[model samples]
Target: MIILMGIRDDEQVQRLISLDSKSSLADVVTICRSYEAAKCATSAIRAPPDQLRAVSAYKKGKKNKGHEKNLSTKPSPTTATFCKCCAKQHEPIACPATQSICTSCGRQGHWARTVQCPANQAQCLFCGHVGHYDKCCKTKKKDGRQSGSSGNSSAPNNNKHQDTRINSCRHLGSAAPTATKTPQPLNVLVSYGEATFHLLMLPDTGADVTVIGKRHLEILGIPQSSLQPPACTTTLTADGSTMAPALGIFKATLNLGKRSCPARILVHEGVQTPLLSYGHYKAIWL
Candidate 1:
C-alpha cells in the first residue's frame, strides 16, 4: 500500500498492485529494472542527429588538445540563434539574409527592428495596423460615408454653408483656379478624454493643419474654457478668403477603425466645415 501510494503512473501502480497480490518483492524488483532498461534504449534511438554529431566531435577533440579550442569557438550547424544585423546567423562581416534591409523605407545599413520605420510613425490611429490608415480600413469603411452622397452635413439644407470652410489665415500658395465641384467630406470619430463625437471634415490635401468648429465643443460635452490659446491667430478658408480669427486650440484624440491618434485641432467660431490637413492625412492614409 505504501509503494502503490507513491507511484504516479496509473498503469505502473495497477500492475504492481496485481503483481504484489500474486507474487513476492523479488518479482517487483525485476520488473522495475526491465522498465528502466527499456526506457534507456528508447531514448538512445530518439537522440537528435546534431546532438550525436556534437558528442562524436567532443570525443574526437578530447584526443587532441589543439582541436578543443576550435570546436568550442565554432557554433553548431543546427543550433538556432538571433543575429544583431540579420534574421539568420552568419559571419561577423556580412549577413547572408536580406532581412538586413529596412522593410519601411527600403534603405540598407539597419533592420526595421533597430531603426524606426516611416510606416510605424504612419500607423492607423484606428484598427492599429500598418501599411494602411483608418480611412482605408474595410471594417470601419461604412462608419464615415454612405454610398452616392458627398457627405452628411451636421446642419442640413444650409446653402450658406460651404463644404470646405476655413478661418482668418492666409491661403497657402497663389490662388490657382480649381474645379467648382466640391470635394467629398471624411467623417472622423473624435474623442476628448471621456467625450466622443463624429465630425464631418474635408480632406484638404492643400491645408497645413487640422481645424474644427468651436460649436463641436458643445457636442463633446467640454466647455470652451478648456481650450488653450491658438498657436497662430490667423487661418485660411477653402476659397482663399479670410473670416474670423481662431478661437483656441484643443488637443484631442481621433478614433477611426480600431486605432486612435492624438490630434491638434484649431477651434474657430467661423469654421462651418472641419478641415483635415495634408500632414495628418499623409501620416494616416499615404
Candidate 2:
C-alpha cells in the first residue's frame, strides 16, 4: 500500500497492481527503471527565455566588472534571441549552421543535433536508392507487372511455399493494385541496446509481432547471429503462407513523439520495411 501510494504516476501504479504471485521485487524495479529511462531519454528540460537571457547578462557583467565597459550601450543579452543551431544570439531560422554538414546522415545542409533528418533524405533499404525509404520503393515484378502495395516489393516471389523453412510474405500479390490511395508510413525513432535508428515503418494491425528486416539490423549495427530465437517456432503471414523462420528476435524501445513503448522485434531475412504491430501502437498511443 505504501509503494502504491508513493507512485504518483497512474500508469506506474496500474502496472504494479497487475502483477500476480509470480512477480518479484526485480519486476517492480524493472518497471520503475523503464519509466525513468523513457522520461530521461525523451524529454529535455530547458529554462525560460527570460531566465536564460538574465543568466547570460549576469555572466557578461561579471566578466567586465573591473574594466569601464559601457554595458547599457551594448545590446543586452536578456533581449537577444538564442540560436540553437550555431549557439549564438540570432533569429531562429537564420542560423549560420545551416551550411554545415550533419554528422547523423552526412548531409551538408543541416545540423544533425538541432534538426530531425527527413526520411526521404535517407537511403532506401529496398532499391538501394536515395530520396525514399523501402516502404515507398516501387520495384518491378517478375510477371512484367508492378508489385503493387506489396511490402517486400523488391524481392521476386519464387519458391511458392515449397521451401522447408518458414517464410512470411505479408502482401505478396501478383496483380497490380488499382487503388490510388497510398498507405502513409509511420515515422518512428527506435533505440536498441545502444544503437538508434530513424525509421519509416508500416503500421500493421494484421501482424501479431513487430518485424524488422535483416538490412535494418545491419543498419542498427546489430549482427544477425547475436539475436535470440523467438518464442514461437513457426510463423504465419497475413496471406496464410508460412513466414521464413525468423533470423532472430531482440527487444527495442520504440519512440513516437513523446511516447515510448518496449517492443519485442523479430528479425527476418529478405524483409525490406519494418512492420509496427497493433499491440505496440496501442501501448505507445493509447
Candidate 3:
C-alpha cells in the first residue's frame, strides 16, 4: 500500500534536531537521505532557524537577514503593477523613471504606468473606480460629513468632533498591510541531468510551489531561454498571505533516504531556499 506523509510539526522537528545534536538542518536532511525517512526531508525543514548553522564554528545572531531583507516583515507591495522585463514585484526598477522611461503610469518621457512596451493606461483595478489607480484607490473613504445645522451652541466641541471623525476616516481607510515571509534555509542534494550538488532549500508548506532560485539556475547550467514561464498559480504563506505569479517551474530530483524521484519545482528569487510544500510530501513513499 502506498502511504503519504505530511509536514513535521514543531515537536517532530525539535526531536529530530535534538537527536542528531550535531547535524545541521541540511546535514540532517542528508542523514534522512541515508536513514529511511519516508517523508520529504522538507518535512523536518523547520528547526527554530537554529539548525541552520555551520559545523565549523557556530554563532548566535538575528533572523535570516538575507531572506528578511528580501521577504521581510515589511508591508507587502500595494501596487499590483509588475515589471515588464522581469515580472518582479514592483515596476520602478524594471523600467526606471528617467528620460523617455516608463514610470508604470503610461506617460512618455516620465515614469511609465503600463507594464508592456506600448504603455496603455488601464482603469483602476480596485474599487472599480475610474480615474484613480489601484494603489491609490479611495473607494471606502469614510463619510466624515459632520452632523450639524451650522447653528450649534457648542462651537468648540463640534469642531473637535469633526476633526476626530476626519482622523477616524483616515485611520479606517488605511488598514494594516500584509507582511512578507522569511523562510529558513534547508540544505539538500538536488540531482539534475546526472549532476548532483548540495543546495540550501527553503521547505515551506506555505509555498504553493517548490521553486528554484533564478540565480541558482546558473549552477544547474540551464539557460533562462530554455525554461518557459510556469503556469499561473497562487501560494499561501504562514503569514496568511499569498505569493503570486512565480517565475517558472522546473523538473528535478530530490534525493532523500534511499529515495529519489522526479519532482516539479518553481523558480524565484529573494529567498535562498527551494520551496517545498505539503503536496510535494506526498511524492514520498511512506
CA RMSD for every model?
Answer: 19.8, 33.0, 36.5
Residue pairs in collision within model 1: 125-259, 125-260, 126-258, 126-259, 127-258, 127-259, 168-235, 169-235
* TM-score to native of every candidate shown: 0.37, 0.37, 0.32
* lDDT value for model 3: 0.53
Candidate 1 residue-wise lDDT, 88-111, digit = tens: 556555655444456544555556
In terms of lDDT, which candidate is stronger, 1 or 3? Answer: 1
lDDT per residue, candidate 2, 26-84, as tens digits? 88788889999987765534546787788889998888883556655677556657665
Q: Arrange candidates by lDDT, highest first: which order?
A: 2, 1, 3
Ranking by TM-score: 1, 2, 3
lDDT of 1 at 74: 88
Candidate 2 global lDDT: 0.65
TM-score of 3: 0.32
Q: Which stretches of candidate 1 lie over 4 Å from their true place?
A: 1-183, 238-240
Pairs of colliding residues, candidate 2: 166-243, 166-244, 167-242, 167-243, 167-244, 168-243, 168-244
Which numbered prediction scores highest in lDDT against the true structure? Answer: 2
